[model samples]
Structures are given as C-alpha cells and as structure tokens.
Target: MEALNKSFFLFLASRPSLDRFAKRWGSKFGADKIVGGETFEHAVPLIQNLNSQGLRVTVDHLGEFVASEAEARERTLECLQSIRMISAHDLNSQLSLKVTSLGLDINPELVWENMIQIMDEAVKHDVFVTIDMEDSSRTQATLDLYKALKKKYNNIGTVIQSYLYRSDQDLDDLNEVKPNLRLVKGAYKESAKVAFPDKSDVDHNLKLLIKKHLLNGNYTAIASHDDAIIQYTKELVREHGIAKDQFEFQMLYGMRSERQLELLAEGYTVRVYMPYGNDWYGYFMRRLAERPANIAFALNGLFKK
Candidate 1:
C-alpha cells in the first residue's frame, strides 16, 4: 500500500490524463462532496448544516496560481463576498485561502494587497482567515506574508505541514508571535531532499508537532485521521491539562466521519473542512492518494453497477 501510494502521487504529478478519471468520478460524486463553491450562494446551505451539527467550518476558495493581477483581484473579491454570506447566515465558519490563488506568483505586492483586502473584510465580519501552506517552493513566501498579516490583523492564522523537515523551525519562529496554527501531514507531491519521503517520518513529525503545540502554543488545530496519531494527541492534551476548546481537531468531511463525530461527542472542539467547487478532480485525487483503500472502495462502487 505504501509503494502504491507513492506511485499514485508520482502519477498524479506527471500524468495529466489520470486527472480525467478523477474528474469523471468527481462529477458523479458531485462537487459539494469535495469543496464549498466559487460563490457563497452555493455554499451557505451546506455550511449552515454543518454549523447546526455543532461543527465549525473553514471555507477554501479552491483555485490557485492565477497568472494576472486582475484575475487574482477578482478571486479576492469572490472570497470577500463569500465572507459576507457567512456573516449573513450567522454561521460559525472561517475562510481558508491560498496565497497563490490570490496572485502570489504574479507579484508579491498584488498578493499582499489582496490579502489585506480579505483580512480587512474578515475582521469586519469577525471571521478568521487561515492562510494555507502550499508546496515547499512557496512555503517561505507564504510564511512571510502570514507573519506580516498577523502583525496587522487581529484574526489571521496559518497552516504548517509536519511532513517537511523545516516545520520544527517554522513552529519556533511562529512562536515569537504565538500565531494560531493548523497542522497537517501535508498533501503535495514533494521530493525527498526537502520533504520526508517515509510515511513513518511524517507521522512521527506530526505527533511531535502536536505535542509541542499542546504544550506551548495558544491554540492549534490537529488535522489528521491516523487513529494512532489521534489517540496520542488526546493523551497529550490530557497530560498538558489543555482545555477542550483550547484547540480543535479538524478532519476532511468524508474521510473519517465516525472519528470526527466521536471526537466532537467526547467534548472536543471539532471542525469539518467542507470543500465544494467545480474543480473537484485535484481534490478527489488527493483523497485517493492519501489512502488506497478509498480508491479501492471507489472502484468497487463503480464495478458494482
């Protein structure tokens, strides 16, 4: 399964055609199963439903790397409008954005401008914004923007991937500001030179990072489904005397329903990352890559018909 998982990641990075298969499956399953939407009008009902279930949500815009400043600015506005809908609906949801999607690749100034706009709007709505970490190539730039924005905005946060060797240092630097962090085991195609290639190493880092956050940070979000990791985190929280609401446990909506609900029922703050958008291929493929069992289940569902 490990070899197959690695091969699937390589295939996703190199073979464009495999995306077609992912797209077909995504179309059948529908976008709401993956991401929110390009517009809040389409995402509000799902967001409201999750909020009703005692779960908080983080909305992601889902596109990345616009080549022109104008395009990026438009996406930024779309995100702002989404925030307005969240406020209107009175939902406990926050916006999660990718800097690349806001034009980081175009010009740093454009990225900063768009970020400032979104952060300002988020503050107006009392909504928080989480800057998602992308590939290693963009990590430094993302961290820089996050730190700068954190200095000016009252409700801005960032994500860190434990799969990278540098994340320990990133956590230490972020400690100076005591920023809110969402820690994930990374979900990108990365090389061994920069990212840990072994699953055990990644899992180890995840546990270590979680322990550090519970012991030292103001607030942290543990975002993973590995049962062992989840159990260890529960133990660490107890050992450190961290209150249930001091941190949150986040999981992808469809990946681990039972575990997420169990955590919530056990009095821990839980958030479901509800992704919905037209571009479901990339998102769905990553889900399959994360666990071959998901792919097998998907394939079996198709064959049964």
Candidate 2:
C-alpha cells in the first residue's frame, strides 16, 4: 500500500494536464498547509515567522524535471529570484535547488550554467546553495555536478540519501574537502537494485551516515522527522561533544513545529525546509509520499473545500 501510494501520486504528477490542474486546484485541497505559499510575497512572512521562532529555513522554489530549455530557464530564474529575496529580507534561509528543475534532463551543461548563475547570486548574499538529490537515475550526474562546483565554491553543498547503496562511498569520496551535506531518507520511488528494499536497513544506514559525518567534523544537516532518528542523532552529538553549529536538524515546514521549537530550546539548530511557488503539485505530492499520515490532512482539505 505504501509503495502504491508513492507510485500513484508520482504517476499523476507526470501527466501534463493533471499536473496543470493540480497546480491550479491543489492548494484548495490542502497543499497550502504543506507548501509555504505560491509566491515570495506569500512565503517571506512565513520565513520571518519561523526565524522569529528560532528555526532557520532552506527555501526551495517548487519545480523539477524540465523537458525544455524554456521551462528550465524560467524555473532557474525563479530560484535566483528566491535567493535575492532571501537576502533582501535578511531571512535566516538559504537556497535548495533541484538540478532537473534547472535543465539536467535537457542538458547537464545547461544545468551547470544555470547553477553557476544561481551560485553567483547566492555568494553575493553569503547564502549557501544546497543541490537537492533526486531519484537514483540522477545520482551519479548530481554528484558529478557537485564535485565540479566544490573545486570552485565553498558556499554550495549537496544532499546524500541514505536509502541509496552508494551514499556511504559517495560521502567518503568527498573527504578531501569535506563538503557540507544534507542527509535525507530519500522520497522518490526507486528500485531495489539502486535503493534499499527494507525500511529497517534504510534507517540503520541513516544513523551510520550521520555518525560518520558528525565524527569527521563536517557540517551536516540531519534532515528527517522520524523521532527515533532524531533522538539517536541527539545521543550521538552528546557522545561526540558535537556543538550545535556542527550540525542541524531539518524538518519540512509545517509538519513538526513543536518538535522544531523543542530542539531550538535545547540549543540545537533547527532548519525548516520550505517550498514556495505556483509549481507545487509535485512537491506537495512528494510530502504525502514521505508521510502517508499527511494524506488525512490532504483529504480533509479537499472535503472542506
């Protein structure tokens, strides 16, 4: 049932007409509760509010998998604009971008060029840009892009998903520079050949990865909402004497506010991942895929509408 739910929503997200319709009507069905908002004007106040609460944020302009240069360029520009907005408002947020949204499918070089533009903008404001990892298919290409950027900029970073078998090696290969990382228990529906087939194995690997990085003295983002994983991370930090600045706990915005505040009060840094844009159906669906319990909220939003 869980696998079916993920695949079903992802399939709907791929169809152009259905996606267009969702982009128009999804919020009425409760996407608003998950996605921060549809525009900067709507999202900034929310970022400020979260900042006021002692939680920093990583802002993503909702988009992915562009089929053409035009779509990719439009999406890239919006991300650049998001960076500028974050800086202008002095919001305690940075940029998180998906390469596919910037034209990885159209051409890797195009995506690289778009990245350079966004990275340049982010640097001016001293904000870091973290490249969000997608499905297994793009894993190698995404790493290639991140490595290329690593030589030129320290202000950018990338994610490593524990569900992928290659993540341990991938994280190790970066030891020379110890690039900053956001570790996530991936969301995309993936195959057993490329990803773990069991949840227990994935959870186990998540702890292993977090422990390895934190011990290495690298900046790490523990991006999970699972109570077990979060609690284990806290224990690991205590044992290693890892200061709050060395790592942060990241959760999706609006999903775990009380927990975020509790972590902050405990002196650990907490960052909320917030997505904002008209292109939101796919992003919201992925949130549902990650936590099936959210479907109840989505359904209630639909019924109320």
lDDT for each residue of candidate 2 in 241-280, tens digit (9 for 90 to 100): 8898899999998787898999999999999999888888
lDDT of 1: 0.81
What local lDDT does model 1 show for residue 23? 55
Report how far residue 181 has shifted in candidate 1, in Å: 0.4
Best by lDDT: 2
**TM-score for all predictions?**
0.93, 0.95
Off by over 4 Å in 2: none
Top-scoring candidate (TM-score): 2
lDDT of each residue in 52-136, candidate 1, tens digit only: 8788898876777677888899889978987897898898998888898899999999999898889889999999989988889
User: What CA root-mean-square deviation does each model show from the true structure?
Assistant: 2.1, 1.5
lDDT agreement with native, every candidate: 0.81, 0.88
